[model samples]
Target: MNSLADPRVADLLARLHDEADAQRRLIRDRVASLADEAPGPEAWPHHMKDFYLPVSREQGRFLYQTVRATGARQVVEFGSSFGVSTIYLAAGLRDNGHGVVTGSEVVGEKAETARTNLAAAGLDGHVEIRTGDARTTLADPGGLVDLLLLDGGPGLYLDILQLLMPRLRVGAVVIADNITDSGAEPHPYARWVRDPDNGFVSNSITLKGGTEYSVWIGLP
Candidate 1:
């Protein structure tokens, strides 16, 4: 017995798979390089809750490209899990002459690890590591955010969204990671961003689970 599907569908699936694999390979290479330069095990104590799920190097490159393309000079991130994403954001900011990527990590150890990692990546100067709950840290961010990455607590996403909206620039970009889990959409963030009144044009792409990209449309 043979179970063959439509030729076109199969072809499309193959193409997508191939693309995904290529992206994975790229991300792997980047992560490996980062690992080589990362601080020793002594820095582990400062990390936040072991939520150090690093983004693929390809994803990091994609993020950097997005930030550079936007010409954003100020960036803010809600979670600095070992500074993996922070390095990527800082790389982009570095290329744009002068910019800062401020990140908050609730755990002191994790924040310290992030600091060490960013420093090893030669990005410490371009990135600021804040050790505390993101809610409190964001409450008084001293800069305008042209780009925001939400990788902190998904439960606090709505609250973070509300808090950061006012500080975002007119054409700011917000990227949220981990939107779905095992085929179940677990976070309300995507829904909130999709709401019409939110003034955010958002969509989810199936990359490393699922990532939501939302473009803020300024205040109403």
Candidate 2:
């Protein structure tokens, strides 16, 4: 189940990354056009329809390694845009011998596309694509979650995390994407997780975009 080496997984990931790369210019233009607008999630749907928002190739590999290293049996992903990141997470779980990655996507079309991509990579068995706002779709993950990934709307990151906070296993890792350059959306989430009183040890990792990497120390 070492999917990293599996030709199908490799092929699918490569193609998806290329698709993202091709949209880089469009994304840049869109950002420039909205330079005067306060950055937030309200405009996310428009962007999603215009282009693909995905983790960079390196970041994707990092996600796979992160999940595998943690020995996570259950993973909760706050976003599954086209399933690019989902593939990486599911691959990690498959390599772990047994695990599941449950992903939440608010966009119905993106959720459908994501499922198709995961199936194409032969990793569908390890992923569940729940279509709806993560806060509601992930109300309960069945049991303790060993890892959480937040790559959806920044404005909702804190809310999503709060919804899943009680379900986190001690030492569980939370990885949030697009944390920087999105104005103040991530500030609340960063503050909450970075505060020792909140029971999380958190720091930012600089990827293509910033990612807040936090570890849950659990309730004292």
Best by TM-score: 2
Q: Which tens-of-lDDT digit does each residue in 94-187 have in candidate 1?
A: 7766788989887887789788767756667788888887888878677778998888757677788789888888789998878863446535
Question: What's the TM-score of each model vs. the native?
Answer: 0.74, 0.90
Clashing pairs in 2: none
Model 2 alpha-carbon drift over 4 Å, by segment: 31-43, 181-186
Worst 10 residues of 1 by lDDT: 1-10
Candidate 2 per-residue lDDT, tens place, 1-220, comes to 5787899999888888889889988888888767767455655664556466888887888999998899999999997889998999999999998899999888888899999999999999999999887888999888999999998867788888888888999999999988773575547678778888888999989887688899999755
